[model samples]
Target chain A: MDPASILLGGFASGMVLFIVSVGLSVTMGLMGFVNLAHGGFAMLGGYVIVLAMKHWGLSFVPALALAFFAIAAFSVVLERLLYSRLYRAQELDQVLFTIGLVFVMTAAVTLGVGPETQVIRLPDWLRGQTDLGFMTYRTYSLALIVAGTLLVIALWLGFERTRYGARIRAAVDNRRMAQSLGIDVGRLFTVAFALGSGLAAVGGGLGAEILGLDPNYPLRYLVYFLIVVAVGGLGKVTGVFFAAILIGVLDFVLKIYFPKGGTIFIYALTLILLLARPHGLFGKRGT
Target chain B: MDAPHTAAGQLARRHRFQWWELLPWIAAIAAFFAFPTYLAFGTQLLIVILFALSLDLVLGYAGIVTLGHAAFFGAGAYTVGMLASQLGWNEPLSGLLAAAAVAGLIGFVSGLVLLRTHGLTLLMLTLCTMALLEQAANMGAHWTGGFDGIPGLSFDKILGLFSFDVLYFRSQYLYVLAVLLLCFVAVRMLVYSSFGQSLTGVRENLLRMHAVGAPVRARLVAVYTISAALAGVAGGLFTQATGYVNLSVLGLERAAGVMIILILGGYGRLYGAFVGAVAYMVLEHMLAKAYPTAWQLGIGVTLILVALYARNGIIGIGEALLRRLRGGGQA
Candidate 1:
C-alpha cells in the first residue's frame, strides 16, 4: 500500500534476516566450513519458543529467552560432538554432514509435532497495529527493529573493539600464525561456533511469526540465510547486516510490486555481485 | 592409455576392473523379465539412477559442486511432458531425443556462464538458475499447470512395435533398461577417454592444467553439458513411465536427494550410480514402510554416518577390504 509502510516493513524483514544469518556468516568465514545446516539451528530455536509457550505456559519474551539459551547450550554439544571432528575435513564433507543434520532436524520436528506450522501467542498489546504519525504499523515490527538494532550494536562492539575480537580477527586472518602466537585457535573456534549458534537461536525465536515455524523451516529458509552470507561476505558482521537489509528491502519491494519475479532478481543480484566481486562487497581479498 | 609404473605408492592409484562391474548389468537383465509385479518401482529406480549418473559426471568425475542440477531434469521432464500432451508427438524415442536436446541446450548455455566460477559460488549459481526456472514455471501456470502439476501423459509404443502392457509392464522396463545400458557404456568410455583424463587434471590442479595447455573451462562446460543431457534423459523417462510432471522435481529436496544417493554409492565410480541408486531406493522403500512419518530421519542419519565415516562410499570400503585381505594372504 503506502510507500512508508513498505519501507518500514522491508526494514523489519531485513532485521530478522540479520538475526538469522549473522551467526551463519561469521562461523563460515572464520572456520572455512560451509554449514548448510545452519538454518536447522534456527528451526530448533523457533520450535523451542513454540514449545515453551504452548506446553510450558510461558509468555513470549521468557519463552524466547529460554529458547535462545537452550539452543545455545545444545549447540555447544553439537560443536563438540560432531562439528569439532570435521573442522579440518573437506568442504564437501562439511556440506554433506550439515545437510544430513538438516534432514535429521526436519524429520525429528515432523515426528515430534506433526507437519503443521507451530504458532506462539503474543501479548495483546503487541498483537495489533500502532498509530504512527502518517500511518499505523505492526507493533511487533517496531519491537523487532529495536531488538535487532540493540543486538547489532552489541555484536559490532564485541567483534570490533574487544581484545577477544582482536584475537578472533587475527586467528581468522592467519590461523597458523595465530597458533604459533599461542592463541588456542581450536578453543577459539568452539567459542565462535557457540556464539553464532546462540545468535541464530535468538533471531529464530524473535522472527518466528514472520518467517513461519514449521518442520520444513530449515530446508525452506536455508537458501535465504546462505544468500545473506554469500552476498554480504562470509565472516564479516557489518557486511552481513548491510547485505541482509539490502536483500530484505529488495525482496519485499519486488514481491509487493511484482510477485512473480522476486527470486530471479535477488538471486541474479547475488550471482552478478559474486562474479564482479568474488570475496563479496565488504570482504577481504582471496576469501 | 598406458599404465604408469612406479613404486608401492603408485600401485594404490591404479584402477583395475573388478567383477562388480558386471553386477549391475546382470541384475538389470535379471530384473528385466523377473519382476513383473514390482516393475513400476524398479522403473522409478532406473530413472533415479540415471539422474545420479549425470550428477556423477559433473560432481564425481569433474569435481564440480552443483546444487541445482534438477534444473536440467525439470527441463527434460517438462519438454517431454509438453511434447506428448501439447504437440501430440508421443513417439518414445523422439521424446527422449527432444528431452536431451532441450536439456542439453539449457545445460550448455548455463554452463558457459557458470564454468567461470568455482566452489561455493558455482554451487549458488546453479541453484539460482534452478530457482529462476522454477519461478518461471510457477508463474506460467496457465501452460505448466502450476501447483496442480501436469498430468495425463501417455506415451506411444516403443518403435511402433512393443506396446506397453498393463499387467506385465515389460515393455517400459525393457525400454528403460536398454537406454540406461547405452548411457552407462557411453559414460564409461567418456571417463576413460583422454578428455576425461584432462578434465580430472583440471579438477586436481587448474594451474597445472593451464600451464600444460589444457582448455580447462571448455572441458568443464562439455562435461557439465553431457551430465545435463543424461539427467534430461532420466527426466523424460520419468514422465513417460509415471504419466505426470510435477514442479517438485526442480526443488532443493530433489537435488539433495540425488546428491545423497551419489555419495552413498561412491562418487566418480562408474557402477557407483547403480549401487547407490539401488541401496538408496530400497532403503527408502523399506524405511518409509516401517516409519511412514519419520522415514526422512532414517535417510538423514544414514547420510550423516556415511559422510563422517564412510567418506569414499561402499566401493572404496570394498577396495580397502580387498587390499587388507591381499596383505594378510601375502603375510
Candidate 2:
C-alpha cells in the first residue's frame, strides 16, 4: 500500500481508538475508578449493531443509534447498581467486578450468537471506495474520520466550556469539594459513565468496518485501547487523542511494513515511550 | 512452627490447622488414587486443581490480582506441543523444563513492565501482554498452527515406562496427581519460608518493606516469575493430558476462568487454589451437563454472589462453618 493509503487507514483507526480511549480516559481521569468493563460495553455495542444490521435488517444510522442508546442505558444500570458500590472500594474490587462483567457479557454473547463470526455488511452506498486527490479510500472509512473529528471537537467544547463539563471537572478534581459546593456528584458520575459508554458504542459502530464484529473483538481491541490510555496518561482527553494517533500510525506502519514482527515494534515503541515518560506523553506528574 | 502465646495468635494457629483440613486432602488423595476404578471426571479435576495451585502462588501468596496468567500456561503448552510434535522432543521432563523456561522468560520481561504500575495499570498491563501474545500466536498460524491449534501432539513414554493412552485416563490421572503433589509440596515450602513472608510483606506494605531495606520490586518480580514458571509446568501437563494444544488456552475467557477459580477458592491460601479449581470444574461440568445453554449465567450469578457475600472464598466459608460447629459443641 502507498504511504497516503497507510496514513488514511492509520487516521481512521486512530479516530476509532480515540473514541474508545476517551471513555476510558474520562472515567479514569474524572473518577478514580478503573472501569475495565468499558471494553465490555464496546463489545456489547458492536454485537448489538451487528445483530441489528444482519438479523433485524436495520440501516447503519438507525442501528448505530440503537446500539448507542442500549449501551448508554446499560451504563446507567451498571453505574447505579455495581459501579456505585465500587466507587468507594479499592482498585482490585473495580477490576474484579469489571472482569466478572466481561465474562458474563462474553458468555452471554457466545450463547446468543453461537460462537460464530458474524460479519456486518455495510450498506451499498457505503460499501465502495471514493477516490481522493492523493489516493482512493473507502467512503465509510473517510466518513468515520470526519465523524470522529467532529465528535472530538464536540467533546472538547462540552467538557471545556459547558456548565455540566465544569461540574464534572470540579468533581474529578475534588469530589468532596464538588459535593460541598452542592454539585450532585452521584448524578454527575452516572452521566459521565453514560457518556463514556455512548462514545464506546459509537466507536464500535464505526470501527466495525475495520475490526469486524467478532464475539472476541472487544478483548482484541482492549490491549490497543489500553496502550493508548496508558501512553496518553490515565485520564486526559487530549492525552488520549495524541496517544491514540501516535499508536495508530505506529501500528499501521508496522503492520504494513513488517507484518511478521509488528507486535515487537509496537511493544518496543511502548517500552521506549514509557521509560522516557512513565506518567505518559502528556500526563501530569504523580498521575 | 511453634504457636505464639498471644490470644489472637493462638486462635489463628488453631484456626490454621483444623482436623477438617486433613480430611479433605486425605479424601481427595484417596479418591484420586481410586479414580481409575470410577470414571474420567476425577482426572480432569486433577488437572484443574494443579492449574489453580499455580495461580495461588501469585494471587494468594503475593497478593497480585492477575487477569492474564493463562498467557504463561498457554505459552508453555504451545512450546511443549511444538517441540514434541515438530522437533520430536517426547521426553516429558525435557518438555516441562522447556515450558517452564519459556514461561519464566515471558514472565520476567512482562513482570518488569507490569510490576512498575500498581492497581489498574498493572491489571491492564498484564491483560495487554496476554492479548498481544495471543494475537502473535494466532497470526503465526504456520508454526503455532494458528486458530486451528497444533494437533497430533504425541508422546511415547512419560518417564520411559508409563505409556500415555487416550481412552484409559487412569495413568494420566496418576501422572498429573504426582506432579500436582510435588508442586503442592514445593509451594507449601515456599509459603512457609522467609521468602514467602517477604512476598506477603511486599503485598501488605511495599513502602514499609522498602523502608525496612527489603528489595520490594525485586521480590515481586521474583515471585511473579516463579509463579509463571509453575503455571508453565501446569500448562505442559495440560497439553500432555489432553493430547492437543489449542488457541483457546490463551483466550481471554480462559484467563477470566482462572481468575474466577482463584476468587472461588480464596486468595492467600494454598489449599484454596486446589479447592477453587476443583469446585469450578465440578460446577462447570455439572452445570453444563444440566443446563448447557444457560450454564454461564449460573456461573456469572455464582461469581457475583461470591464477590458480594463470600469475601474469603469457599475455604474461608468452610472454616467459618467448622468454627461455628465446634463452638456450638463446646457450648
Candidate 3:
C-alpha cells in the first residue's frame, strides 16, 4: 500500500481506540476506580454486534445502536452491584477485582461463543473502497474517521456545556463535597459509568473488524486502552483523543517498518511518557 | 489493623515461632518422605512459595503493587536455562546463585526507573517493562527459542553431590525445600531489619519517610532488588526441578497468579507466602484435574470473591485465632 493509505489505516485504528478508550479515561479520572474490566464491556459489545448482524439480520447502524444501549444498561447493573462496593476498597483490591472480572467475562464469552474468532458480515457499503484519483481507501475507514470526529465533538459539547457534565465534573473533583452540595454523587456516577460503557460498546462493535473479536480480546487489548488513558491524562476527553491518534500512528508506522517490534515501541513510549508525566500528559497532578 | 509500619514490623519480629508454626513444615517434610508420588507437585508448590515470598517483600512489606515481577523470575529462569542448555554450566547450586545475581541486576536497573512512580503508573510501567523484556527475548529466538521457547534443559548435579533422576523427584524436592528455608530465613531477617522498617515507612507514607531522612527511593530500590533476587532463585529452582524453562515464565499470567497467591495467603506476612503458594498450587492442581476445561472460571471466581470479601486471607484468620486464643476468646 502507499504511504497515505497506511497513514489513513492508522488513523482509522486510532479512531477505534479513541472510541474504546475515552470511556476508560473519563471514568478512571472521575471515580479513580481503575476499571480494568472496561475491556470486558468492549468485548461484550463485539459479541453483541456479531450476533445482531449474523443471527438477527440487523444492518450495521441498528446493530451498533443495540450493542451500545444493551451494554449501557448492563453497566448500570454492574456499577450498582459490584463496582460501587469496590469504590471504597484499596487500590490493590480494585485492581484485582477488575482483573478477576475480566477473566470471568473472558470465560463466559468463551463458553457462549465456543472460543473461536467471530466474523461479522458488514454491509456492502462498508466493504467497498472509496476511489480517489491517487489512491483508494476502505469505506469503513472513512466512516470511522467521520464517526470518531462527530462523537468526540458531541462528547466535548456535552461535557463542556451541559448540566449532567458539570455534575460529573463536580462529583469527580470531590465526592463528599459534591454530595454535600446536593449533587447526588451516587446517581451521577451511575449515569456517567453507563454512558462510558455505552460508548465503549459502540467502539467495540465498530472496531471489531479492525481489532478482531474473540474471547481473549479484553485482556489482549487492555494495555492499549490503558496506554491511551495514561498518555492522554485520565478524564481529559480531548487528551485521550490526541493520545489515541498518536498511539495508533506510532504503532502502525512501527509495524509497517518493523513488524515484530511495534508493540515494544508503543509500550516503551507509554512507559517513558508515564515516567515523565505519571498523571498522564494532560491529567491533573496529585491524582 | 491500620498500623502496618514500625509497630507491625516489631510485633512480627518479636512473635515467637510456636509449635503451630512448625506444624506446616513438619507436615511438608512428612509428606515429602511418605507421599513420593506427590513430590512433583510438592516441588512446584515450593517454587511458587519462593516466588510469592519475593512478591510479598515488595507488595506486602514495601506496599508496591507489581504486575511485572515475573521479569525477575523469567530472568533467573532464562539465565539458568541458557547456561545449562548452551554454556555447558551444569552446577545447579552455582547456577541458582548466578540466576539470583542476574535477576538482582535486572531489579536494580528497572527499579531505578519504576520506583520513581507509584500506584497504577508503577503497575503499568512494570508491565510495560516486562512486555519489552519478553519481546527482547523473543528477538533472540535463534538461541532463546522465542515463542516456541527453550526447553530440554538438564542439570549435572547439586554442588557435585547428588544427581537428578528424571522419574523420581526426591533429591530435587529436598534441595528446593532447603533453599526455600534458607531464603525464607534470610528474607525474614531483611523484613525485620531497620532498612525493612524504612521500607514500610515509605509504603505507608513516602513524604514522611523522605521528611525523616529515610532515603525513600534507595530503600525501595534495595528491597526491590532483594525481592527480585529471591524470585530469581525461585525461577532457578523451577528450571532445575522441571528440567525445562520457557517464556511462559515471563508471561503476565505468572505475574498475576503470584500476586493472587500473595493476596490469598495474606500480603506482608512471611508465612502468608508459604501458605498462599501451597494453597494456590494445590487448589490449582485439584481444580485443573477436576474442571479441565473451566478451571479458569474457577480461579476467576475465587479471585473475585477474595478481592471482594477476603482481602486479608488465611494469615489474617490465623492471626485472629491466635489473638482470640491468647485472650481467652475476647479482645
Candidate 4:
C-alpha cells in the first residue's frame, strides 16, 4: 500500500483505539480503578448497534447514537452496583472482577447472539473514497479522523475549561483532598465513568469494521487498549491521543511490511517503554 | 481474616510438621487405589495443582500479581518436547530437569527486567513477555509447531524401570505424583523459612521491608525464578504424561485458568493448590459434560463471585467458617 493510504489507515485505526481507550484512562486516573471490563462496555455497544440496525431497521448513524446513550446509561447502573463496591478494593481484586466481567460479557454475547462476527453496513456517503485537494482517502477513514479530532477538542475543553472537569481532575489528583475540599468526588466518579463508557460505546460502534465485532473482541483487543492507556500516562486525553496514534500507525505500517512480527514489535515496545518509565510517558513523576 | 504477611514470620520461625498436613498425601495415595482406572485424569489434576502451587509462591507469597505465568509453563513443556522430538533425548527424568532449568533461566532473566516495576506495569510487562514468547514460538514454528503444536512426543520410561502407558498409565500416575510430592515438600520448606518470611515482608510492604534492610528486589527475583522453575516442572510433567504439546499451553486462557485455580484454592496457603485444582477440575468437568458452551460462563461466574466475595478462595471461606464455629462453641 502507498504511504498515504497506510497513514490514513493507521490514523483511522488510532482514532478507534483512542476512542476506546480514553475512557479507561479516565477511570484509571480519576478513580484509581483498574477497570479491565472497559472493553466489555465497548463490546456491548457494538452489539447494540448491530441489534438495532439488524432488527429495528435503524440507520447506522442512529444506531450508533442509540448505542452511545444506551451503554452510557447502562454503565451508570453497573458503576453504582458493581464497580462502586470495588473502588476501594486492591488492584488484584479489581483486575479479577473486571476480567470476570469480560468473561461474562463474552459468554453472554455468545449465548444471546450467535458467536459470529457482526458487521455494520455503512451509509452510501461512507462507502467509497473521498477526493481531497491533497489526496484521496477512504470516506470512512476521513470520517473517523474528523470524529477523533472533534472528540479530542471536546475532551480538552471538557477537562480544561468546565467546572465539572475541574472537579474530576481534582479527584484524579487526590480523591481525599478533593473530598476535603467539598468536591462531590462520588458524583464526579459516576459522571466520568458514564462519559468514558459512552465514548467507548461510540468507538466500538464505529471501529467494529476495523477491529471486528465478535464474542472474543474484548480479549482480542485488550492488550491494544491497555497499551494505549498505559503508554498515554493514565488519564490524559492528549497523551492517549498521541500514544494511540503512535501505536496504531506503527502497528499498521509494520503489519503491512512484517505481518508476523507487527504485534510482536508492539508488545516488545510496550514492555521497553513501561520499563523505561513505569509511570508512563506523560505521567507525572512520583506517581 | 488474618493477613498472610503478618503471620508469615511467626509461621516461618515456629513452623513444624502438623499431623493434618498428611491428609492431602493420604488422599492422593488413597485415590490411586480407590479409582485405579482414572490415573490419567489424576495425573492431569496433579499437574494443575503443581502449576497453581508455583503461582501461589509468586503471587500469594511474593505479592507479584501476574497474568503471564504460562510463559514458564509453556517454555518448560516446549523444552521437553523439543528435546525429545528433535534430539531424541526422551529420558523422562532428564527431560523434566532440562525443562526446569530452561524455564528458570527465563524467569531469572525476565524477572530482572520485570521486577523493576510494580503493580499494573509489572503485570503488563509479564503479559507482554508472555505475548512475546507466544509470538516467538509462532514465528519459530519450524520447531515449536506454531499453532498445530507438537504431537506424537514420546518419552522413555521412568528411571528406565517403568513404562508410561503400561497398566493403565500406572507408571505415569505414580511418576507425576512422586514429582508433585517432592516439589510440594520443597515448597513447604521454602515457605516456612526465613527467606520465605523475608518474601512475605516484601509483599506486605515493600518500602517497610527495604527500610528494614531487606533486599526486596533480590528476594522477589529469587522467588519468581523458583516459582517459574516449579511451574516448568509441572509443564514437563504434563507433556510427558500426555505425550503431546500444544500452543494453548502458552495461551492467555491457560494463564488465566491457573490463576483462577490458585485464587479459588486460597493462595498463599500450601494446600490451596490441591483444593483449587480439585474444585476447578470437577466443576469444569461437570460443566463441560452438561453444557459445553456454558463452561466458559461457569468459569466467568466462578471467578467473579470468588473475586467479589471469596477473595481468598475456598480455603479462606473454610477458615472463616471454622473460626466462627469455634467462637460460637466457646460462647
Using lDDT, give the best candidate's number: 4
The TM-score of predicted model 3 comes to 0.94
Instruction: Output the lDDT of residue B118, model 3.
Output: 79
Scanning candidate 2 chain A in windows of ten residues, the lowest lDDT window is: A89-98
Off by over 4 Å in 4: B1-14, B166-168
**Residue-level lDDT tens digits of model 3 in B37-141:** 989888988899999999999999999898999999999998998888788898998999999999999999999988888766888899998888788888787
> Model 1, B1-331: lDDT tens per residue?
4345565445444444567678777887798767768888888889898999999999888899989999999999988988877789889899998999999999999999888877667777788888878877777777788766798778888899997655566777878888998998888779878898887788788899999889888899999999999999999988888878988878888898898788788888886788888989999999999999999899889888878888777777787899999999999
lDDT of 1 at B85: 74
Please provide, for model 2 over A172-225, each residue's C-alpha lDDT reduced to its tens digit, 9 standing for 90 to 100. Answer: 677899999999988887887898898898788778777666656666677677
- In angstroms, the error of model 2 at A3 is 1.6
lDDT value, candidate 3, whole model: 0.86
Q: What is the DockQ (computed on Cα atoms) for candidate 1?
A: 0.67
Residue B81, candidate 1: alpha-carbon lDDT: 87
- Which residue ranges in model 2 land beyond 4 Å of their true spot? A47-59, A110-127, A131-135, A170-184, A253-261, B1-4, B8-18, B33-41, B82-88, B109-113, B131-149, B320-331
Give the Cα error of residue B273 in candidate 4, in Å.
1.8
Q: In candidate 2, residue B104 scores what lDDT?
A: 91
Better of 1 and 3 by DockQ: 1
TM-score, candidate 2, is 0.87
Distance from true position, residue B289, model 2, in Å?
A: 3.3
The number of the candidate with the highest DockQ is 1
Ranking by DockQ: 1, 4, 3, 2
- Taking all chains together, the TM-score of candidate 1 against the true structure is 0.95
- Chain B TM-score of model 1, please? 0.93
